[model samples]
Target: MSESIRNLLEQVKNGQVSVDTALLKLKTKPIDDLGYAQVDLHRVVRQGVPEVIYGAGKTGEQIVGIISSMKANGQCQILITRLSPDIAVYIQKKYEMTFVESAHIGYIGDIPIQKTKSSIAIITGGTSDYKVAEECAVTAEFYGNKVERVYDVGVAGIHRLLQNLERIMSAKVIVVIAGMEGALASVVGGLVDVPVIAVPTSVGYGTSFGGVAALLSMLNSCASGVTVVNIDNGFGAAYMANMINHIGESK
Candidate 1:
């Protein structure tokens, strides 16, 4: 059961909340319709995480309306991914939000304290991949996982990555982001005992084919524990890493 539902049940068991009140809380509407979007109000009850807003292709007003509906329904610690800076600024004016321009993410409410016993590491092959790396970092952190970041340590300078070997080896989960040949994932995968999530970005030369080459390379990685996500999908990679990190947690 979700934490919220469990809390409600506990209140009723302790006689702190009347049965009718508990029933009312349980029977609350599962969704809020705003015409343009059907905001999911029960996702937190189903999944440990609430429904995240995809800010791309959404107007500032529409995003605000969806967030408002979620907030009214008692959803806290919302995350909006692929958000543009302008829209983030507009939403910031109406509600408290921290915008990370590099990651194109807008986070609202205080971040939950990390409760997972293990930490997640996010590594990037090059500085150009920092945007995607930041996306993974922000998403992992928002999901309440402790994150360690290692940036610009691609194969070009293997020594840099080697320097952080101890830190990388310490994480329970590792995310490797790259755009060119996507070899970093395999290198990290071979080194780490934990799972490695590879993310390909659309950052390469003409022959890179908008990350297809890198995606294919990662998909075909010879390393045993390497798995690949969609190109430029840092959020997905982080989500999977968070789940892996929390495998033994009570929640």
Candidate 2:
């Protein structure tokens, strides 16, 4: 901070600075326009959260710009979800210490890393659903949550889900991704006491309607704890799960 800014803060501490003055200092926290990128730096200060990079539409350069800006202050862990393999490659080459899984949905880190014995499991109904499940796991890991994945355990093979019952039920939260009829979420919901964030992926054929059937099925889940995100929204599911688990970790 400059001498002027330091004096301003001192006045605020001494009760001489009006609320308006405090507002001005806090207002500078967010949204830095870098022409190509508009960074939301104030999110962490204002909302107790940091901005995330939505990696699907933007070029590798734009993502680099956003994540690099978040890393500038060295406070918040940066996350970029829905990163394609090509972009992941570019990011890996640029940021040497960061992990770039070609199959991963994103990356995570900042300050003292968060970890918990209380785990979050990413569950998927079928092999085709692995990508979304991977995304959920990666994003959760980035947020400092310990994550486990239970893939290819949809209702088609009741035995598979049955095999992992202990792990699934024990988790703090379960993110279930599925396509086809999306019956897995309802089944998992009925069995587990914890929250189930249902993710509908565009993984099935004709009647699946690009996961619409699965999305509706998840929304209509008879199971009480089931919550559904948009079709193919693994990132949204993970983000919500992090928010829910964040409280427990802090306690």
What TM-scores do the predictions have? 0.95, 0.82
Task: Write candidate 1's Cα lDDT for 55-97 as tens digits.
Answer: 9999999999999999998887799999999999999999999
Instruction: List lDDT for all candidates, in order.
Output: 0.92, 0.79
- Would you give me the overall lDDT of model 2? 0.79
Candidate 1 accuracy as lDDT: 0.92
TM-score of 1: 0.95
Considering summed lDDT, which 10 consecutive residues are worst modelled in model 2? 96-105
Instruction: Give per-residue lDDT, candidate 2, residue 237.
Output: 87
Question: Per-residue lDDT for 58-151 in model 2, tens only?
Answer: 9988887787787784444677776777888888787743554634555655523658668888899999988777777777777677888888
